[model samples]
Each structure stands twice: as structure tokens, then as C-alpha cells.
Target: MPTFPAQPSPANKSIALCVLFPVFFLAILVSHFTLLRLPYFWDEGGYYVPAALDFFRTGTLIPQSTVTNAHPPLPTIVMAGWWKIFGFHILATRVLVCLFAAAALLAVFRLTRTLLGEKAAWVATLLTAIYPVWFAQSTLAHADIFAAAFTLWAIALYLEPSEDRPQLKVAALFSLAALSKETAIVTPLALAIYELSLALRASRNRAVPKIPATKHLKSFAALSAPVLPLLTWYGYHRFKTGFIFGNPEFLRYNATANLSAYRIFLCLYHRIVHLTLHMNMFVAVACAIAAILMPAIAPRARLSHPVVTAISVILAANLLEFSILGGALLTRYLLPMYPLVILICVAIWQSHMARLQWFWLAGLTAVAFLAGIWINPPYAFAPEDNLTYRDMIVVHQQAIDFLQAHYPEATVLTAWPAAAEISRPDLGYTTHPYKFVAIENFSLIQIQRAASDPSGYDTALLFATKWAPPQNALSLSRHNSANDAKYFDFHLDLLPNEAAAILHGEVVWKTSRGGEWAAILHFPRIVDARLNPPR
Candidate 1:
């Protein structure tokens, strides 16, 4: 592997960055297109969809009020603007996300160099360029890409010298960051701690006079600039949901869905142990550990290193206690923090930037990139553990297209999870535009009971991994109608090696004597093809 130059030279820095920037962008572009556009990630459907709702109806950039994706105003705000250009194509959404990813990369580059020397910055940027978890998300329509940028930018500013106007910029960017996502709310708190540390350091400077009481009060107040927007969000959420944060629905859902404490600790330990086994990734993880340990190992000199300071701040901001932070440990979830992680690696290496040391660091980064591709980090959920990106998107698309071609005018129903996979036409759910009903309404026992009942509808389509017919559904006219119930199944392979067992054919059930369910299951449905995609 090629090595970072032994001595940090400004010219070398420029050349290295010049060579790196294009490579990074190309990786991003290729991943974005090659992933078959990965059509609207699940989170995109749930959160970002509503952000575009206002613009879809009013044709305005500032979308009308919505309940979902309510935390971040900027991404929704940007999405609203793009909705006009593409008029609602999923491609357009991907384009916006790609653009944001590029911009986020630039931010990483800038902050990387600012903290680490130029060589370390290049190493960090290069590693970030190829991190699969981050790469996967950079291609989607989720707001996290932009949210990560805003959050990182806020952290960057706070870490810069106080007199450089970074404090004020930190305040502004921190607000923008917080407004981007609930995860980003950590930005301001992180900034406040770092700024407080800076203030304390300044106060103890012998040459600098003690901060006067009034000045100290004023300084503290200035640090609070980011609080306004956050407080506004809080007040609005309080009035709307009777909660301080936005969208009480998510909390309720998470409370029921997410794993509890004992499980949480187990998951954390599992991930830590899981990552530890991967040689290449473990190297990067080791760097992260060293970066954390450095400040304590040699506090005086470590504090002097701007790069060390930057990495420390990022780690503190991101590595929340296991009790509070919960997620599937997606690389993108930590992507906003990868640049810092990379810098930490560089910081550990830079303190010993011999020619051989540079070579070793470069080799390890390359190993990480290779492992990233080899393991195929599970950024997006996979139905089968080993399912590839092409399998997930391309094969899934075919199943949808097949459905549309075969049942042009029929309502299609899927099991709980599979239902999400095919809720719309653009996503390739095909068939005619039929009303979407949640499969969660039925339990296993109920499904079997419904399966036994013959006096229902004539034919119903089932789409899912596990096929269980719902007994008493709104779409069923009568609970036990002695009607024909034909179970047709579609066997599809998203990839040659991996096949999706789809249960979307037809079901025969009954609705009560007279209701909406009677018409729903009985009617044939297909996409209008006239309604534009979600704007």
C-alpha cells in the first residue's frame, strides 16, 4: 500500500487531497447508482415521506405541517425544494441525498485537515470514502446524511479557536444540526461541554486575567445561542403532542418495539465482541480506542494536538452511554462520526509518523476498506442474512413488476413486514393502486382461524415471508363466509442464490353485510400511473 509522506508538506497535502477527493466522490457516485438506487429505505418511507406531503399538495417549497420526519426542518426543507424539480421521483430524492453526501464529505475533508495534519486528513477521508455503512446511506433519501453533516460541522466549529468566530458559528450550526434530527440534539450539549472546557482552560491561563463575573455571565449567555431553535421545537412539540420532544408516537412505538435493558446490554456486548473479531475493522476500532486513551496518556501534549482534540470531542459526542443510545449499530448511524474515527487513527499514527509507520497506517486503512466490501456491512436490513444489494433491490423490483403485470386490478396484501416492502407502485409494488392495509391487525391464531373459514371472500393475495391469512379484517366482509379461498404463491429469487418467497396471490374472505371492506377485497386494483411519485 502507498504511504502518507513521512514529513507533512503543504504541497504534498494539496496533491494528496487532490488525488483523494475525486476517488472519494467516485466511490460515492458508483455506490449510489450501483445499489440500484436502493429505492426509498424504510426510514425514508416513514420519516421523509411526510416532509414532502405539504409540497405535494400545495406545490410549495416549505411543505405543510407534517407529523413524521418532524425533527429535522432542513432536510425536509431541502426535500421540499427538490420535490419541485423532480416532481416526486424517487431518483430525485436520491439525487438530493447524493448531493448532501458529497457536501458532507467536503466537510469531513475540511475538518480532518483542520485537526489532523494534511496526511492524516487524507487517510481519514479515504477511509470514509469507502466505509460501506456510510456508503449505503449516502445513496438514500434519509435525512441522516445531511444531519450528520450539520452535526459534524457544529462539532468542528466548537473545536476551533474561540477568537476565530467559531463559537458563534458553532451556535448557529448546532441549531441547524439539532433541527436536522433527534439524534443530532446531542450536538449542542456536546458543544457546551467542549466550550466550557475551553473556558476553564482560558480562565486558568496565568497571562490572561480571571474572567470577570459580568463577562463570565455574558460568555455563558453567548454559548446559549443554539438554545432558541431547540426550545422552539420543544414548545411546539409540547403543544402538539403534550411532550417536550417532537412526535410522541415514535417514543410509544420504540417503547413497545425496542429491546429492554438486559437485552440492550447484551446487544452492546455482542456488537463490541463482533467488531473485535474482524482483523481489519478491529484495527480501525483499535485506533478509536487509542484516540480515546491518548488525552489521558499524555494530557499536556495531547491537548496541544488540535487533531487529538477534534477526535476526542467527536468520540465524546457520539459514544453515549449504552443505556440511552440504541440502534442496529449501522455504520451510517456512526458515519457522522467516522471522519473523527479516521482522524483518531491518524492521530495515533501521526505521533509516530515514521516512513514505515505511514505505510502501516495506509495498509490498515486499505485493509479496512477491503473488509468493508468483504463483510458487506449490514447497513440496510436484509431479509436473509447473506442477501446482497443487487438481490434486495433488483429482484424485489421484478416481483413488484410481475405483480403489476399479472394482477392489474387487484388489491394486494402482505404480511406485516413484507407489507412495508410493497406499499407503493414506484417502489415496484405494481398491480393497480390498491388501498394499503397494515398486516399487524391479525394474530397467528386469528390467521389460522380465518384460514379455516370458507365463507369469506373468493380470492385474496398474500405477500410475506410467513403466510398467515387474517381472519376478521376490514377487507373481509364476513368472518366465516363459505366463499372460495385460493392461495396462490409467487416464488422469486431477488438473486440467483437467494430467493424471496412471496405470498401475494389472492384471498377469499367476507366483509360484514355492508362496509368499506366488502368493496376493498372484492375490487381489482392497479396503479393509475397518472399520479406523480411522492413529491
Candidate 2:
């Protein structure tokens, strides 16, 4: 009996909505900063921040010694510039990243408002603000959030009524999306599909003739024009490394090494299952299923409604790209997709749930809000089921503290992540107190050689984070004979270096956080034996 207007509200209400939306976001940010004091998260300290520092040091756009151009360089380049301007302390870096997150939140609200009505827009924005993955990543310098920011705003621009130079503006935004992360190449495809769908629907209404195929082709070409910069970067990369995306070693080690088809379905299933189970009281899917049957239940509110159709197409396209092509199903990769889901769910809520007298919507929405508090990186002491952001940051910081206190002047052999963090100048840790030997992979031979060199380290500190496996697991194998396999059997989530360190070196002290451990290891005898193997 009531119709929701799609056009702008009264001028006074419009002004009020704009003011309240930003105030809400500011409050969320202030609350988050007061609650959590996250260090440079796992990837930020280890990979992203280090890479950005290297670029600044070398004055190059590309990260120095980049392997897989797994991500496009723009995010790192931009972050490096930010670090240069603001200085690279953890709080500063995190605050800078939060700015992008803020922008993304605004874009989500604006887009949802355009497609759905005001009530749905507010619901969608609130959901995005509280969504665990998006919220957690907002504080760190990971590129996923940055990429999502670009993609969300680009879609918002693309959805606006066509205007003079609209093609140029949208294409530029899409180009930024791709540059932020290569996976955002899905944007053009989603846009083209939405445009085609609109044309087809118009034709069915007999409002206009079906658009010519050539016109579609021309539009697509214009949409694709901004990709030339991406192509040029690939050209440069190929020239430098003899590979388009990265060097052969990078592909062998990073790209193809851990990739598995099984992870694809696992990724899709986990997000759906986890988010629904945690946030929706398992009602999201049931509601979604019911929406699919809406035509049978209510003739007027088809699931094929245009807003639903457009957002659904984009969400589906993005999921397909990640499942088929993503190297790994990192939670970060799924962050951009969740906001779209929120939009669709809200659309369903508006069109059918209210009219059907479905009380489940109210219950599920309350569950989502309550679920927000529980939505954080697992605790440092949480079980091995998942490694939260806290787990990662605490583990690394503990390792760095142990090294600095115990072997202040010793040469340390560590995986790149620990090495990068300890070496970081912004953390206010003295990098000079310990000489660091950064190694990508662990090896007895390399350690021995480094220790034996006249100018090399006399005492070697072996530091392992959760990501690196020991190059020499021979020690773990030897101990396994004594029924110690359980000690070395790292769960699917952790690396194997801790067991190897225990077997080869005398553990002066051991420390652990979450499922990961780092120990101060002294391996004099093992180094000597390896330097002069049995004849």
C-alpha cells in the first residue's frame, strides 16, 4: 500500500542524510582506533611496507627485486609516497590506509542509495562498516582494501546517468581499479553486461529499437582504452625480467607452487559458510533461496529486478575471476565482494521480506550487528583453526624482541618477513644492534657459509614466522623417529621452521603466539659439520 520514491528526497532531508552519513563513518573510525592497536600486519610489515620502502630507496616505480607482479605496483607506489610524506610509523601508515577505507564506505553508501532507496543504502553502509574482513583490513596497508576502494567508486560513477565525457571518466576510474589490483579487470566485463541488460529490457518494452552490435563494440573499445597503461607496465616488466608478470623464479616459487584447484571451492564455500554462520544466523542463504522463489510467492517482486540483476552480475563476475585465476584464496581477495552481497541482501529485504511479514529479516539483521563484535582477526591465543591479524603481528613482534634482547650483535638468519620488520626504521627498534641475514628459504648450507665467512656473523639467530618452511627439514625427520612427529607437524596454517630450529640449534629461549613460534637458536656444531661434510 506504500511506494518508496526513487528520486532525491526533499532538499532538507537530502542535506541531513549527507551530514549524518559522514558523521556515522567518523564515529566508527574513532571507535576502532580506540579499541585496537594493531602493528603492521603480517603482509604489511613483511611484504607491502618493505616493498614500498625499497621503491622509495631506489627511486623506482617498481618494487626493488619484485618477483611476481602478483599485484599491480600502483598501490605500493602510492603507499610509498604516503610514507614519504607522513613518515612510516605503524599508526601513521594505518591511519593513511583508513582514509581509503573511509572513501570506500562513502562510495558504498552512494552507490546503494542510487540503486535501492535510502533505507537500503543506510543498511548496506552499516553492514559494510561492520563486516569483519573489510573492517580489519581497513587498518593495514594491504592492497585489497585499496583495490576495493577503486572498484566501488568506479562502479558508482559508471552507474550514474550518462553525461558528457562519462565514458572518459568511467574509463579512468576503471583504469585506477585495474592499476590498484589486476583482478579488478572484471569491472569492464560487469559494466558491459549491465549496459547490455538495460538495452535488452528497453527493447522488450518497445521504448526503443535494439541497439546495434557496432555501437556495443564501440562502447566496449572506449571502456577498454585506459588499459593501455597496464599493457605498457607489462611490456616494461617483460623487458626487465623476461616475463610479463614476474620472473620465472617468482612464478615457480610463488605463483604455481601453492596453487590448487581445490582451494577455489574451499574459498567460495568458506566465505559463504563462515559469514552466514557467524553474521546471519545461517539465515542469509535461506533468505536468498526464498528470494529466488519470489516469483512463485509474489509476482511483483521478481529476483530479476534490475538493481538485483546488476549487482548480482557484478558479484558473480568478480567471484568467477577470483576462483578461476586467483593464486590463493586469501581472505583479502574476498573483501571487495562482501559489500556487493550486502547490497543484494538489502534489496531482497526491501522488495519481499518486509511485505511477506518475514520476521527473519529483523532477527538476521540483529544477528549481523551482534556478529560485528566477534568479527576480528582470531586472538593470538586462539586455536589453530585460523590465524588472525593479531596472531600475525604479535608473533613477529615477539620474535623481534627476543632477538634484540638476546643476540644484540649477532648475525640473524630469518625469513624475509621478520627481516623486513626488524630492519624497519619506523618501529623505533635499533636495526644496528643485530646484523640480519635475510633468506627467502631456509638452508643449513647457506647458514653455515654465512657463519664461516670471516666478515660474516659469529652467532646466527634463526627467526621463523608462520609463512616460511625450513629448507632443511632433515632435523625434523631425524626427531620424527622418536615419535616427535607431532611436535614438527605444523597444522595446515603454520610453517615448519620451528621444529627445524629446535633440532639443529640449542634453544636459548623460545616464544610463541597463536600457532606460530620463534626461538633464539645457536647452531655452532651443526654449522661446522655442514661446512665440512663427512668425507
Candidate 3:
């Protein structure tokens, strides 16, 4: 074993940071190719890749996706720049997401070290590095990784020693985070509220002592600083897209479907705590218990040093995420929180280097790794994640080449969401030709829009769903009985969508691989809504 320096002086912190950061990042960069070579999952193909292509070709900041509303444009728009250099390689595009994810990991490691101690920090970092959700999401072109990294940076900057420049940096990071995803806008405000709480606590202890007026003023400014960016972007998006949010799809999701306030809130919170507990109920429980014990640990750990301050800022961010976004429902959402928690854990280990404490640290790290953080959950999810990653770019690549050569610049309408958005949301919806209410879901509006509006464009090709498999078992809803299940459960047992039924038209393309070991199907139906799917 090559022994290394345990604790470098504050001056040498920069060198240590420089050395470890790249090593951790490269581990992911190398691991990405080794692990998998499936095509871009679903949304990466649908929303992200297309938006990147649009942004790259059009050079537009607003990367307008065909899906048009569920999320913000920053992730896709930024991906355009990467596509410029990487030249449409999924591996190369993933590297950008991976870099952001690496940044998030480094942030988590530093956060843990600051709050807890070196040992605990390492434990937390190791856990974070291997967490399946974190590992998976980092390798995909999703906004969460960027949001997470910037979120951590914002928390770090906010928690810095009461300095003006640091406050400004915090503001900038928060702004960038918000840009990455609309949900992140709530983070900074949550952070501000927490700092206010700290200020009040300190004030209570000192009636006669002069208040840290400068810090409060700075906090207010930091809190207010984001208004400019929000307003500017709001105006820009509104003017560009004829809507304030700039995406009609989000509006539809919000007004028509999507989780209600109570549901969203409950789901988000349950998601976070559950994931934490699932990773290790004890670690989650331990963190909660340790928080109550912080007053005692702070005095012993010299943690009142900058480490504690950083933890405070991150705690503020965590609260903001929980309160505003409802919770870090997913690990990617808590990427910033991971660092803060790690720092706190590290600080805790440093406070008392007892046998039990080290054992606890080991236990937590072991559990987190077992939970599969190293693979990253949010990105690299299995079949569930498949829809997000299955961009069908490989399929599309051939299609694109064929179309460009034969029917140059024609618009293509694909049946599988992967062909269009490469995301599953399309398939999730049932078109009006058949309504299987018992199925997971179907967006009537999305069906009408996609199916009805093909006449306006000269689309050359349609990449239809070649195969369908049960992603999960479906239980009948209250509104549905056995008969209702037939439509969605299988093509052979479909029901009427008004007068229409499943496979309700001429079967144009059907093959059994010429008496070999395969099956193929191509069927189209014209719906009552005038939404025709070609055979």
C-alpha cells in the first residue's frame, strides 16, 4: 500500500484538490464506454438530441424541442455546443453529462470533508461515486447532472466566509442552476430562508452585541440577485415562444396531466427519503440524529472553521430543495446535498475517531455502494431508464441517411417515440383510435397533435414500433375492468377507441422473417379525430 499524506495544510488544499478531482473524473470517463453501448435511451433521443441538432443547426439559444414544454431548454442547448465538437457521437455527448456529474461528485466530496472530516468525506465520496442512480444519470445527456453540479457550487459559494465576492459567485451558480432546469429556481430562495434562520439564532444569543449587519445585507443582495436573470430570461422566452415558460408542452402537462400539488409534493419527498433510507436506513437515520448532536460536535471538530460554514450553506440549499422542489425526490436532485452531507459526515468522523465511529463510517459507505450509487441511478436506470436513453439514434442514423439521399429535407413521422423524441412519453399516451384506460397512461392531446398534424409537413419516413413488451405488470384502475384491459395489454385483445379498435386498419407490413425465427408488424389506422397512422 502506498501511504499518502493524511491532512495537508490549508495552503496545500489547492494541490490536493487538483490531484484528486481529475482522477475521480477520469474514472467515470473511462467507465462510460466499458459499461454499455446501447443507443440513446428515450428522451435523450426525443427531446435532447433533437434539440441539440436544432440548436446546432440554427444556432439558437432557445433550443426548441418538438416536445415543446415539459422542461427547460438549457440542457439541450448546451448539448448543442458539445455536439459541435463531438460530432453526434452519443459517447462524446455523454462525456459532457459525465463531466458535470464528476463536478457534482467533487462538490459532494468537498462538502463532506468540510462538514465532517477527511475520513467521513472519503466514505461519503465513495458512496456517491458508486451510487447506481448517480452513476447512471451522469452517463446520460440529462439536465440533472448540470443542475446538480451548479447547485452544489451555489451552496458552496453561499456558505463561504461572509465575503462579498463569494456571495456574488453563489448568486451566479444559483442562476446557472435555475437555467439548467426550471425547478432549480426554488433552491436559492430556500437557501436564503435558512440563512435567515441562522441569523435569527445568533441574534438571540447576543442582545447587546452588534449584529453582523454586513452579512445580512449581503444575504439579502444574494437572495435578490437572481431576480434580474429570471426576469430577463422570462422576457426572452416569452417573446421568442409566445409564452412565458416558452413551452406549451409543460402547460399541457400541468393543466391536463402530471402530479397534482399534493401528489407531486408527496411523491418528491417520498422519493428522496425513500432513496436515502433504501440506500441505508441507518445512514439516513444517523444523519438526522447527528444533526441534533451538531452543537456538541461543532465545538470539538474545529468545524466552526470554514467547514461548518460550507455545511451551513449546503444545508440551506438542501432545505430549499426540500421545501421548494418538495424534496430531492431522486438522488440526482440531491447531488449537491450529497456533498454537503458528506462534508458533515467527514466532520463527524473527525470529531471522534472512535472505533464505533469508523465502523459507522465504513457501514454507511458500504451500504451506499451496495445501493449502487457508483452506477448512478437517475441516469443509468435499467428498463425504466431505457426510455430516457433509447434515443434510437442508431435507427435514426440509418433513417436519416436514407431519407436525405432519397427525399431530401422531408419531415419524418415516427410511430415509436424513440423515432421522434427517443423518449417514452409518446408511447405512454394512447391515441384516440384506441383508449386503454387500464394502461399506464395515454395523452389524448398528444395523440391528437402528433397524429392529426401530419398533413402540414412533407415527412418522408415513419419508424414504427417494431416490438412491444410489458415493461411492468398493469393493475386495473377503478374505471377499468377486464374488457378495458384488452386494448392496452395486447394488440390481439384491443378494444374500441369510440368506433375504432387496436390495429384498426389495413396491415401493410407484416413479416415472419420468411419462415425463420422472427416476427414483424406494420399496421396503420385513420382515427375519428382525422389522425391517421400509416400502414
| Candidate maximizing lDDT | 2
TM-score order of candidates, top first? 2, 1, 3
In angstroms, how far off is 459's CA in candidate 2? 7.5
Q: Which lDDT tens digits does candidate 3 get at residues 223-265?
A: 6576567668778777777777645656643443333465455
For model 1, residues 1-535, the per-residue Cα lDDT tens digits are: 0011223334534644456556656666775575534555455654565456565667543324434423646676778777766777766777677767776776677666655556566666667766555666676666678888777766555554333344567667767876676666664665455556656666676785444333433434455666788678767656655656434555544333345655455445534433342224567766546545543432211224544554565555555532245434333445576666665566666654454755586677677665655354322222221123334444445555554555554444434333444554444334345444444323343344434542332223332331112333332223222211211111121211111112222333322211112111233335367876797
lDDT of each: 0.50, 0.58, 0.50
> In terms of TM-score, which candidate is stronger, 1 or 2?
2
Which residue pairs in model 2 clash with each other?
Answer: none
Model 3 segments more than 4 A misplaced? 1-15, 35-37, 70-73, 161-165, 196-211, 252-265, 278-331, 341-364, 371-416, 419-535
lDDT of 2 by residue, 118-150 (tens): 666666787777665566677768777788887
Evaluate model 3: give its TM-score: 0.65
Query: What stretches of model 1 exceed 4 Å from their correct place?
Result: 1-27, 36-38, 59-69, 197-223, 237-248, 255-280, 286-310, 321-331, 374-390, 416-421, 426-431, 440-535
RMSD of 2: 7.9
